[model samples]
Target: MSGNRAAIRYAKAILQEANEANAGDIVFDDMRSVQATIRGSKELRVMLKSPVIKAEDKRQALLSIFGDQSKYTHSLINVLVGNKRIDMLSGVTESYISLYNEAKGIKEAIVTTAVALSSELEVQVLEKVKEITGSTNVTLKNDVDASIIGGFILRVGDLQYNASIANKLGNIKREFSKSL
Candidate 1:
């Protein structure tokens, strides 16, 4: 939890700098790339979190991996390395993206279903999420979870609606046990 808070602080500072330089969009894309790169590579994640790796080494590795990034991104890397908080890079990127989206009045929604949603269904879900959040700009992410069996789970910010078949079955089982 404390780590997350620290990431948020770093992200806000970077966002402010990027906005002041009129490079918020560029920095936003760079952060997305950073998040995706770190998320995609297991070795990179391990290296970032490894106590044995020197902070300077980690900084150099990141710089080479993400060459040609915006000046703000390079500064963020330098700051994190100096503070010995490079391991929080992924968290910071995520927080930055979330903050950017929020500032742009864009909301992100996640829907977990047993199967991939069709284009028509995705459009419907986007409309529903927009209506619920009262935001015209909404991004929907679909996650497939077979364990749900059927139905879907929708999450928008702090609000979650679980309409999964597994949840209903669990509730029924609990009621049956109480009656017995």
Candidate 2:
């Protein structure tokens, strides 16, 4: 828990520096790519979490992978490596992406349903999300979960609407059990 908090703080600091440098967008893209790379590579993730490796070695390895990234990214890696907090790299990058989105007035909504959303449904969801959040710069992600049975679940930041059939059924069962 504390680690995540520290990661978030680091993320915010870097984001502020990126904005001050007038390279927020470029750094945002770099962080997105870094997040994608870390999430995609099992070996890299393992290596990052391993305490056996020297911080300098890990730093050099990351530098090689993200050679083309912006100066802020390079500095971030430097700070993490110097502080021996390289294990927090992924968490920090993810937090940074979230901060970047919030800074740009972009809200991410995650929709889960029994099946993939049709184009029309997706548009409708986006419209509903905009109405709820009052943010026009909304990004939607659709996740399919058959166990939800039907309907959809919508999440925007810390707010969630669990309108799934499974959830409704559970609520009904709970209400009936309580009446007994």
Candidate 3:
């Protein structure tokens, strides 16, 4: 939507600014922290999206949470608040991470399994993702979801390979219903 497009625009602008200052990596770290902090706190999320709160208060809250950011990051806060788009902070951070990874030529693969992946399994998954993406710079994130029961789901960019037991069971149930 428009909001996402705007977030991407803001992310691109900030990335360019950071790169010009040779602080892209530092800003990338700041964005990751911002994303994690925003994702972890419901109150923060609510405040960002709340129209009842004044822009100054929201800026103060964000500054308090991420006061140690780089100059570019602090400038970003001011710009977003000035534009009255502080509510898009989370989206902006998420877009910034995606843009940063793409700029760095790093592909992120997410693997969801019933339990945490062992070291060997993680290595194997990493190798598989590298092969699939044809990129040596690949990062793997392992997520544990008990509902999957067994097997794993691998996601790289827009590609998703769902081999979870839950999916198989659902397919089987669909087939039975179709036959009847």
Candidate 4:
């Protein structure tokens, strides 16, 4: 199976276990911390993925890092090490985020503009998107593209609303060509 699928499966299992243990919130926080750790440390990732290291060594290392922090997290790390699936750590973290978002009913949106938007404009746009999507929680990622010249593009998951000058030009060009 793909790494993402495996990670998602592992995350689901971990979530189930956390619920059973009455430590769901703790597990979520631990997963977030682990994700941050993986993102911040390339050496740590290499060490975790190294076949030369024994599972016990990996577990000990995880324990040293997160042992006292949260028992559920420590146990989860040990389980990953025992399974020799450290390479999926990043994916697992992402999966956990997705699960968390689902639980919280949050949606992420990306908005790209030719220029930076004012704080008020940004808030207005976010509010509009939240209203349109009916999402209680919305996270926005902004991108600036000078080539766009003007207007903005809003992307909500697989759907995109493009109102950029570049797209307008392309549309006009297409229409002109068809008329030729």
Which 10 consecutive positions of candidate 4 have the poorest summed lDDT?
A: 67-76
**Alpha-carbon error at 30 in model 1, in Å?**
1.3
Question: Per-residue alpha-carbon lDDT of model 2 for 119-138, expressed as tens digits?
Answer: 99899999989998998899
Tens-digit lDDT string for candidate 1 (1-180):
113899999999999999998999999999989988998799999999999999999999999998789878999999999999999999999899899988998888989999999999999999989988888999897889999999999998888999999999999999999999
lDDT of 1 at 63: 90
Which 10 consecutive positions of candidate 2 have the poorest summed lDDT?
1-10
Q: Show model 1 residue runs off by greater than 4 Å.
A: 1-3, 114-120, 144-150
Candidate 4 lDDT over 1-180, as tens digits, reads 114778999888877887888877887778778877877799888987888988788778878876655776766677787788866777887787668666767687779999888889999999999999998699775778899889999988678999999999999999999999
- Evaluate all candidate structures by whole-model CA lDDT and list the values in order: 0.92, 0.91, 0.91, 0.80
The per-residue C-alpha lDDT of model 1 at residue 133 equals 86
Write down the TM-score of every candidate. 0.84, 0.78, 0.86, 0.65
- By lDDT, the better pick of 3 and 4 is 3
By lDDT, the best candidate is 1
The most accurate candidate by TM-score is 3
Q: What local lDDT score does residue 125 receive in model 4, on the 0 to 100 scale?
A: 93
Q: Once model 2 is optimally superposed onto the true structure by TM-score, how far is the C-alpha of residue 9 displaced, in angstroms?
A: 1.4
